[model samples]
Target: MTTDHPRTPGPRPTGATIVWAERVTKTFTTPDGRELPVLDDIGFHLAEGEIVALLGKSGSGKSTLLRCIAGLIAPSSGTVAYRGEPLTGANPGVSMVFQSFALLPWLTVQQNVELGLHAQGVGEQERRERALKAIDLIGLDGFESAYPKELSGGMRQRVGFARALVVEPDALLMDEPFSALDVLTAENLRNELVGLWEGHEAPVKSILIVTHNIEEAVLLADRILVLAANPGRIQAELRVDLPRPRNRQDPHFESIVDTVYGILTGREDAAVAAVEPTTTGGAERPAPTPTSAPLPEVSVGGLAGLLEILVARGGEDGLAEIADELNFEIDDLLPLVDAAELLDLARTEGPRIRVTDAGREFAAADILTSKQLFAHHAASRAPLVRAIVQALAATDGHTLREGLFLDLLRRGFSAEDARRQLDIAIDWGRYAELFDYDSGDGELTLDPGAQDAL
Candidate 1:
């Protein structure tokens, strides 16, 4: 799509700041007694008439920061203010639209939209009128009596929008609102939303959305706040200077995407130092060594598929080029690269992801040979995989007690995190054929055939 009208910053607000977060820090104490820092010294301000997007990788605490601003959760230290007033609890003028439909399946669209009003003791007649107005405004006029299950995903999210808007909030907070929809539907919704804001039809004075999709951020927000992981903080900010109804194919838009990707991946050529490498903040490190933390939950299939693509493309491609080719954002691409590097199957430097000799060999090998090569490298190169194998060996490949591993994991990570990492390890182990897990009995045992092969 294209537009001739020049796009600048949003319309100026009449007065007062809508929301402000100052030196906000949040830390969670895990069941394992580990202090997990989610957000650290993060601060930002949202003005009336501004649409700001908080863009970051998962685990970067974007959602946490959003909740902090909404007063759904309090910061461990620091303060959140709504309109210069210390926000201690949810604001009556603020409303939220969740990513999930969060609709009552049994309730009709009109009832769903009227829920908040009903809670505030609005009369049924007034609530019905307001809900109908919102539904009509959002183009859901006829669907007021439809159930959630009968509505399409886009329609369901439109209902979410109507429900949030029915109360006429001063600010609308959306958490990845369109992520659940298909591409065309999402684009359509984005346009409708921006049109609402531009036409001065939306009830809210400002919008703050938390989203991980880079293109979506650039397309929608007046300003994009980029957050970094490992004690999430505001890493950088980029103001979108393009015209509304942006052309995705525009060189400038692609440049911004590349710049953001560079920023997130630590590529030296990236718009910043080559953007700082995605780090866990230990000793200003370089590459995954043997002692690093557990690998992310990238599938063996994903790693192998990327390696095969690189091999077919002559063993290497520029990181940004690969990202474009694979249609993956930096957050999604990094985990696959990290997983491959963890297995010594791929190496990345500067802006290039290079397939290693092992990667090429694996690409050419039969499935059986591929499995053997993967088993060897995974055992040697990945810390978690090695730990699982060693633990099994030390126990003589006999009975398995997950309690032992779970305890070890919990000592350093949160209960939820430990479980997620263990799940990733299980998938890796099974793919490498290094171990067998019986789901029925909850037993993890060394694969006797794999042991004999080794």
Candidate 2:
């Protein structure tokens, strides 16, 4: 873990480079003699102080790339180098944070954070001091004696982060570190991590994160590397140009999210696949179109049509039954119901759904399906609430209400102000409510109110 920091910046002079992968590739062979290519001539670079995100669906070669860079597995072809030297084995200057938060259950939080230094044969007192400093940097003060079992999920992840920081590696590799946490906690952690990266005046100069979450990628990455599966390869690279502290509700942000969503959902492929050839032509060609024409008057009457259908039906089962009666697929029903739900035009309960108080207001006002309502709901206050609920849901099962706040911190919340926000969400916002806490087992559940909100 302790390696001599390079004196000069830029590429090395000894005919080696900082980190280079020349047409790197990997293939896995099954026992049945079938060969599967996991990576195919993928190439990228990491410059000093740059944060790069590897984004794709599962089996897109993100993990394989990290492992290849770490030298855990040799590439079937291509060369990987560290500091102008070919990496044949594990590289000391690179450290990784796994998604699972791989902490030792038997070890104290401080001890777990200091394990990297311990493995390096650092003296006990020195390791303790370094570990403490790292923990304090992450705002885990006064939790030195806490064991993994006693700490919350978020706290455990913080310990994982502290351990990675204590080593002071030149490059940090994170494999979906925030994906396992709840949305609120993840957002808090993301904010804090960005702040730390901006303020750092240290030797650690580069970061590479692997994730499938489009928002996470856009929020944190300087550049996103999109990979495709079936012999994983770089499909596209997008530079996120938005300024920091990005507003999720911003129109531009929504546009990017939608574009990325399209990419992920295979909608783009479907659109491509839908192209058809012209009949009775020497060469099949696209239909000729007018260069200019008056735009057609657009109306969202379809939404009103949907609302009428929902109102005619009495309950959640009624909505589903109507959908079935009309032969509407789930996808066809989602947008209409979501629109109605967001607009307060409908309320759903278990298998029964109906119009709500706001829906009645819209109907009375004859506001048929204003485009404004769609925008308002799309960029509504619900995202923040949804973010909170998503975080709570990540606990695997139930968790103490206090544990949720701590989990947010571990995901990267500043310990200074997150507690106040948590209180507001639980006490007033109605996003979540405290149920019961057991002092003996530290187990907790959500209140009926919280479940109802969900």
Candidate 3:
């Protein structure tokens, strides 16, 4: 974060449990009346004054778990306790910060900070004092009267922190609060927060943050809880025992980052849980096809771009080094890597991703040739794409109603997810020239000889 204030560890934790979750499970009913499990039998605890980070991919239910702990949502089953008391509703002692700076344009910095105090039925005079105190505490003293519109993104987020602190909360919950800011700004804010926590200037005693950034978790939290997707489960708990004011280049810091990377990319159980079993002649298939899932929202051009980077790096380690070099999270990088693997352009195992022979051929080709190769692999390798083409080919008119794909998708996906998968298919199909979709009548036509778009 910032260097104006030196870093130090916060007050020593008292070993008293502040928040607890026991066998928590969250399930949602899809629009089609099917149950979709987002979280399954998760359990965790936060000690007094301890900072815990929930790290996972986008759909891993990390945010949902945070919401449950914050009492913003009721878990389908299980118990959440704060200070040995069951948290039934919005806990009065908790404050929350979010990725989006949810500030009112009409409110000035002071007024916005005072909003929470006002809701608590606090007196106007006291609200003014606490709001100003928090504003000054969070390094926003000089901008008391500035409207949200007058402040930059970083400044707006400072106001959010001030507002959350004005209540003198016992615990703070942050959901990707730093994600929207630029790199330098986010680092500065993180350091400043560490400063506050160490100095015991902030009112909150404990924090639980949701983030996908691996290094950020190591830098801020004492413990990191990695969640797995497809009915999210707690896959691993890592203790970041490194000293504070952590050096980004230190070997220990690098080691911890690497450890988390291994857990995230190499957890075989997580991979197993995400697959579906299909029977062929009464025997279940061991490996599920990647194409059965939604296609990644990456273009062939994007895949080529990443391949160029791996080639430049001489087939480097997949997650940590590349992500650090590019200032990207595993969440942002994995989709492209996964897409490449599914298309036989690259192979990733553990934390390393290497370009395959097919990948090198595609990389060496001109744009037109690349698309042709991409078209061939997409039609042959991707199960969903292959199924669509075969369906269209088998049809009398070499066409089918587009909704048929959506219906097939719904059996395995939520409505929102089904829609996303369909959109991805449409885009990839158009790029590969595998099919022509007519928006006017919602039809997909097989176009085997579709000309080169490049």
Candidate 4:
């Protein structure tokens, strides 16, 4: 989308101040002539060398705001400026990393990383050097020749990061970049990223990340901008005063998480209860105020029951597979499977599925029944585990396992904890092998044994 806004001629180059969004508002006119306002009176500034996180629930216009700043979509009633000049369409100095990774499956890792540079018309040798540097920087040293399908979830994200970085963008915009990975791998990458950012001689001038995860906001953001919807607007701005390399267990960190949660849930409740009643016959009947109810308790027993059904069907299951086996429809099967998966009663591998060790224990009555045992486990432990799995999955042939670890840290993890967990998962869990970690350089990776737990 090209903009008619004239470029300001000056001796100054772009990237001097980074980004400025002033009173930006975006509205979309639907095909049926309905008008939808996505952002309202939004404003923010990203100074050079700063990382600001945009935090909100889905539909809160965080992504919309990011796109507006990127010049992917124009705002209806406000101006966005980069280094004092009004932004037009896609600026050469700005780049975005999407949540989905969006790597081309047909392309090799090197080719994918070099795409932006190629578009910018860089020479072949320069492109190769830059791409390799980005690859190495992201810890994908050897897998340049490997295809997307050969890499894992976390590794693919690195490729996405590399692609953006290779172009030497002055500002980076990420929309939930770590949301897709398992928890462990996400933490590893988060830590690694912190180190990389800290050690950089010339940093990406500014970063804007959009995320739903409250912990992520606290961990990675210098300032967290909380957005509200129903005509999206900035609700709150939180300065993360915690020191760099934040601790999740810290009281300050937990307080911020709680505050954000309260803001989201409280707003939802108020919105629901504020609906007005229809008048009839010149008399008013007050609308019923909706009451908030706590979520229903889920149990290991329930998870085991669902797992039994899945196992009975030989584990080759999709929503349809479970539905047909149990004589349930797609909707009916969702809650059961979701609850079971939440409790770790089952592990899904693409279309095929199986009961995890925890699930098996529950099914055999070796584990005690409890309300929301699975939910608690997932909240406390699953994030890290899933991250590791995703990192391993995303490696392609280029990135070593250690690079995956660093990437997770960079995404936002306690550095010491991230390293320790990787070691424990490898040594005790027998999940994978850790090749090496050099203080001067970064991590290295090696192959793991069969039957190693993930």
Candidate RMSDs in Å, in order, are 4.6, 17.8, 4.8, 20.4
The 0-to-1 C-alpha lDDT of every candidate, in the order given, reads 0.80, 0.62, 0.81, 0.64
What tens digits encode model 3's per-residue C-alpha lDDT throughout 330-433? Answer: 65787898788888888876667889988888888897788789888887777777778778888898899988988777665667777787777777888878
lDDT of 2 by residue, 1-454 (tens): 1123332323211221357677999987643454557799988776666678888765578998988887788999988888778888987778888899999889998999989999999999999999988888777888999998888777788888889888998778899998788767877777877766655523367778998877788788777777765457876667667766677667776556555544443344422322332234477655321101101111235546666665555423544356568765333454455445544567654334577755544444434243334333322323433344445555667454566454543232223323433443333222123244454663445444343444
Q: Rate residue 367 of model 1 by lDDT.
A: 91
lDDT of 4 by residue, 287-404 (tens): 3110011111233345557777666666436644565566643334434554455445675543345777666545554332322343234323444433444454456642354655
The worst-scoring run of ten residues by lDDT in candidate 2 lies at 289-298
Query: Candidate 4: where is the Cα deviation over 4 Å?
Result: 1-16, 267-454
**Candidate 3 versus the native: TM-score?**
0.87
Candidate 1 Cα outliers beyond 4 Å, as residue runs: 1-15, 29-35, 121-125, 266-292, 318-334, 347-352, 392-400, 411-414, 438-454
Error of 4 at 291 (Å): 16
Report the Cα lDDT for residue 211, model 1: 93
| lDDT of candidate 1 at residue 261, scale 0 to 100 | 63
Which one wins on lDDT?
Answer: 3
Positional deviation of residue 389's Cα in model 4 after best superposition, in angstroms:
46
State, as a TM-score between 0 and 1, how close model 1 is to the true structure.
Answer: 0.83
